[model samples]
Target: MRLTRPMLALTGAVAVLALSACGAGGDDEAKAPETATGSLEQLAAKAKCDPNMQTDADEIRQAICTTGKDKYILATFATDRGQAEWLSGAKDYGGYYLVGRKWVAVGQEKTVTALQGKLGGTMEEGSEHMNPGGSHNKGGHHS
Candidate 1:
């Protein structure tokens, strides 16, 4: 068989279309999977810290756990909207952390890893002051 110019152009166009159709969007355009809420008790059970070390604030639910010599805060939102809000805000705050539909943990790398192992989620690392709202200062000041 002999090659022709039009055929090659058509083939290239088709290839590009096919690749675009099968492509995934960038992170900004990607939608996160809907996450179901787990009971606070379940979260506590998976945490290394005492179940009693928890906060039942209106906006957030959190548990404080200590593993080895590291203490970290494991948190979850009360509603799906809350979860989305927190995830969007926290995604940039680096360090060893895990974010799930119903849970998030922040702490030292090893401590976050141990809890993530028990809880099951993706772990990420980066800077620790990527607050979305610009409310918290690096020096622990909030305004």
Candidate 2:
């Protein structure tokens, strides 16, 4: 075909847009499949826990203070059956964990640790954006 400057530019732009669109939003389910994190969001939303619950941080499903050892264990299943744990204990500070059913709670520590052990994952630490998978860390730093 004949070479045209405008045609080439437009073609390039279109290709870029298409490529960007592919990576636009949400992770791929088929390729990576649904991880435990995906299930947490689903269950929390269903329970009407809070809209703000879904975040890159370990804060509550919302900003509510999860005082007194209370925590939430969001367990997602491949069969669309989501589970939740409104765990409470003895601290005014609580955390949320995006975990799976396979996770087990030892003596102490959030189920995230137990689940992480089962999944061969390190209970994420620090900001969600800092990790490779964008998960919340154990310390639960909302900032």
| Regions more than 4 Å wrong, model 2 | 1-72, 77-93, 96-110, 125-143
Best by TM-score: 1
Tens digits of per-residue lDDT, candidate 1, 37-142, equal 3766676565545644445666566665544445566676666676655555444443445677767666555455555556666666543353322323446755
Candidate 1: residue 86 lDDT (0-100) = 55
- The candidate maximizing lDDT is 1
- Candidate 1: regions farther than 4 A off: 1-37, 51-54, 126-143
TM-score of 1: 0.53
> lDDT of each model, Cα atoms only?
0.51, 0.29
Clashes of 1: 3
lDDT of 1 at 10: 39
